[model samples]
Target: MKVTNVHTRRIHQPKEKVSKLFKTLATTNDLIWPYENWPAIKFLEGLNVGSKGGHGSIRYTIIEFNEDDYIKFQFSRPEGFMGTHEFKIEALNENQTEIRHEINIQTTFETSLLWIFVIRWLHDALIEDAFNKVENYFTEAKKKATYNFWVKLLREIYKRKPLQTKIA
Candidate 1:
């Protein structure tokens, strides 16, 4: 089964700032901790790291990575099935970046079928919600003092109205 989605937004921070955020978000340990805290995070406890970071082996697994571009990893779950998650990042502008996440499930017929059902359920109920949480984090980060210039400009743009004009 294949699941893919793309979400894009204009961030107030420069590409460097956004890149740092993406790097933090993409790291295995960083990503894992949030999951560790949430109830859903516990679902993939035993899945070894396989390969981590850029071209590094993780949990004895071989994963692919493109420096500062993307990362992909594959692992088997407790149910004896394989799955993969890929993350891609792109710079849209000096002050904006795009992040994309893709998920794939590979397994035997019986296991795949079971996972298909569960994955769909989780995608609809939990994964989507998790992505929203990530989006919120980006939004909040853009509002910080470091991003004051962009935020102030945006606020000014919002306050100006073409409809406000003097009538004779």
Candidate 2:
């Protein structure tokens, strides 16, 4: 397995908003790349759902999803190998949330020499870029959402806050 690129971003949004964003990413395929319905099953041709499509569900077949605080997935291509991607969310403050994305690639290359070469070349070049793109997408989305939320909040506060009292 090789560790590619990892990106972390802090979004200035409430915990609830952050959770909603995460949930949107987790449950909605429209927000993700290679856009396709039933992505998990479509990508993993012969896989079966180990449990119901909810928290702690184990995907035994080609693709799998498990929701334990964070939503994680494991997928395998035609090659006899698999990769795992996980997203974690942490509440930083009343108006900030932290998101971390981790990706691991495991291939069937048996020889250490081949593994090292692939890790150094393919991983650094292709896999890292792919993960970075995904991270950038989420980061941009979160930023936009956070900005909108704060703007609206400020507007509401400005409209509601009483005018400053004049000193005698």
Best by TM-score: 1
Candidate 1 residue lDDT tens string, 1-74: 34333434444456565445445542454431234322322212222334322211112132766647665666
TM for every model, in the order presented, reads: 0.50, 0.43
Which window of ten consecutive residues has the lowest lDDT sum in model 1?
A: 52-61
Which pairs of residues have clashing backbones in candidate 1? 50-58, 50-59, 50-61, 51-58
RMSD of each: 17.3, 18.8
**What residue runs in model 2 are displaced by over 4 Å at the alpha carbon?**
26-68, 78-80, 109-168
Error of 1 at 91 (Å): 1.8
